[model samples]
Target: MLLKDKIIVVIGGEGLLGKAIVNGILHEGGVPISADIKPIKDSNNDIDYIMVDITSKKSINDCIEIVYKKYGKIDALVNTAYPRNKNYGRNFLEVEFEDFCENLNIHLGGYFLTSQQFIKFFLKQGFGNIINFSSIYGVIAPSFEIYAETTMTMPVEYAAIKSAIIHLTRYMAKFLKGKNIRVNCISPGGIMDKQPINFIKNYNSLCLNKGMLDKDDIIGTVIFLLGDISKYINGQNIIVDDGYSL
Candidate 1:
């Protein structure tokens, strides 16, 4: 029970990775409040659930207010909320301005807005933890084909936005060090349930992939970053790829 009674706010809790992080928090005896745009599953009733739109400032503000009113304190924040756009995979020449801005809003603006509001709360309380999400793209830039390979990836927009997030995490960590607020990112490898048959075929030919990818592979890194065990770790992008980026 490392987290024993800590209140954790999970953005995008309705999604696959988000849900896994929430479950891991629960397993460690932490109380989780899921904030997502969609209705959370009924099984999550045992924990707290709030419908939130990360793209809107008012929506995020209102959600945080509700959490503060109920939980009295927000100990941790895991920002997993992001947008999906078809225009993300196009070549540099084909990418549209609107699509790129939308992607930036979700990954970059969303982090700033959420952290801005939460930092205020954390400042008042004197302690907080923030675990943001980035991708392998932040380190090793992947191609548009790699973006199209799984739902997790996209070329210019996602990589650009997430790369910005890695820097944002470091900046926040330094600025908030005196206040005891910690910020870090997790760069997951390829996480997928079912790859397109064509993607698997191409991957096998070029990558020598032996087996299908699983969603559970992303869990452990998340657990470590969220717990007190990582107290000394800050402003770092911890990559959990199975040598895919090697």
Candidate 2:
């Protein structure tokens, strides 16, 4: 019960990683409010989610108001929404300038909007926590060889967006100096998402152990951040990649 009774909002609670994080929070005795455009399965309807479009300022503000009124105080905000256009995920060479910009605006811009809106709420409450998602790709360049026989290619837009998030976390943390608000990021290694066998094999070979992380593997880090154990750990990017980046 490390997070006993804490009211934490998971921004992308409907997504793969987001759902896992929410479950982990519940296991630790935290009350997690799912804030996503798509509601989680069933989601208890009324109390399950705070439906939101993170890209829209009004939607985010509404989400804040709803959660605050219901939960009284929001302890932490974990952002994992992966909003992107259909043109996204193209290879670097095939990525048009317009497509790249649009994806960035949708994904990265949404992150900015959510963080800004939440910080305003946190300020009024006197304390808050913000945990953002980055990736191994954000910390280091993609390994193109892993995708040789697969259709999977790292998108340029993803790199730019994730890397930018790292800096934005730091900027927000410093900007809120002595304000009792903490900002941090988690840069995870590749998770086991049923990708091509060749890619998985190549990726595993790079890691020291556990070639690819399970969703549960990342949960501990997030839980740690949400608890008082990491009170002093602010504006830092914790990489949970099993030495994959090494």
Candidate 3:
């Protein structure tokens, strides 16, 4: 029970990766509270749920207040939420400038606001952990050849946002030096989500395992980062992509 009684707030807790992290926390004896714009159904009653709009400061503050009121302390916060505009996955050429900016505001801006707020609280408490999500695409440019037969190409905005997350984590970690708050990032490879067969094959060929990762593949790292075992780790981006970025 590495986490014991630690209380963790998981942003975007209703989604696939979020749900896996939440379960991992539970298994490690941590208390997890799920916060997202969408309501979570069919989850264990022990899991707390809160509707949150990460882009809204008011909404973010309110969610934190509710959690603090109920749990008295938040030991860690895992931001997996990626609120984006409707044109999120559009082709690069087709993506409108306005939509691109909007997506950045909603996704990166939300991350900034949420982290700023939590850092304030962490400062007061003298200890906190923040785990931000990044992607393999952030480290390496996409392989356009992989999508030859598919209508998919990595979105330009996605690359921008994910790369930004890495720098943001480092910046916050350094700024919080001696403050007892740790900030880190996890850059994961493409999780197996029933993507196009051709894309999957190409992606796997680039990886050491020659396979797309499963949702559970990311759980152990989450547990390690959030727990006391990684006390000396800070300001680092741990890539969990099975050498896919190579």
Candidate 4:
């Protein structure tokens, strides 16, 4: 087992990606902790589950303490929490200040604070892995105004914040080098979820023009990063976009 007996934390654990990661960790024999603002349906008394608001410093610190209290040390932290901004649709102009800030806050501030709390433990123990979520959109510009058949579309702040997160992962990886802590990112393509009508219409058009991806496409990358095979692969952003950017 790659992560046998290791304690891992998956932030945004209530979401689809988070739940998938949690299950993967469990399958690998690692103790996966589900950390989120909302409790998941699978959250039980035996397994570790924490309530944390990534945007709040106090809440993050408290959750860190809870993790430390439950498990002696934290082996890894995978942040997959993202801002809820689909309500803006394709209208980039309608994306408000609060919405933008909220998205950026979790992608940037959340990673900084959460890593800050855990790095202390990692530094002391001399072993930790931080896996952040980036997006293929971070690497390639979104088709804001690409003329398909006859329409235009976009996803604004999400791509912006995800790009910022890639840099943050690099910074953390370089800063924690030789301390036995590693930082990396997973930049996945659009997940196959039942998105809103506007998003679906736009995405389908984009897919027809470009291509689409399935959720399972990310599984191999997730396993590789979480396992011991990637011990030396630090401070890198791996893009699993199925040539969406190509």
Q: Could you tell me which 10 consecutive residues in candidate 4 have the lowest summed lDDT?
A: 145-154
**lDDT of all the models against the reference?**
0.79, 0.91, 0.92, 0.78
Show model 4 residue runs off by greater than 4 Å: 44-46, 85-90, 145-153, 196-211
> Could you give the candidate ranking by lDDT, starting with the highest?
3, 2, 1, 4
TM-score of every prediction relative to native:
0.88, 0.97, 0.98, 0.85
Question: What RMSD, rounded to one decimal, does every model reach?
Answer: 2.8, 1.2, 0.9, 3.4
User: C-alpha displacement of 185 in model 1, angstroms?
Assistant: 0.3
* Predicted candidate 3 versus true structure: per-residue lDDT over 1-246, tens digit per residue: 999999999999999899999999999999999999998788689899999999988998899899999989999999999787877899898999999999889998899899999999989988999999989887889988888888888999999999999999999999999999999999999998879999998888888964789999999999999999999999999999889887
Candidate 3 segments exceeding 4 Å error: none
Candidate 2 runs further than 4 Å off: 44-47
Residue-by-residue lDDT tens digits, candidate 4, 119-203: 8768877788889898977888877544345434455876777788899889888888678899899998778785555655655
Which residue pairs in model 3 clash with each other?
A: none
Candidate 2: lDDT of 112?
A: 92
Tell me the tens digit of each residue's lDDT in model 1 across 1-246.
888888999998888788888888898899988889888666646778889887778888888889889888889899988667566666666778998887787768878888887888889988999988888777776744643645543468777887888999999999986788999998876666576776665444433354334566677777788788989898998876665666
- Minimal lDDT window, size 10, model 3: 202-211
Model 2 weakest lDDT span, ten residues long: 39-48
Rank list by TM-score: 3, 2, 1, 4
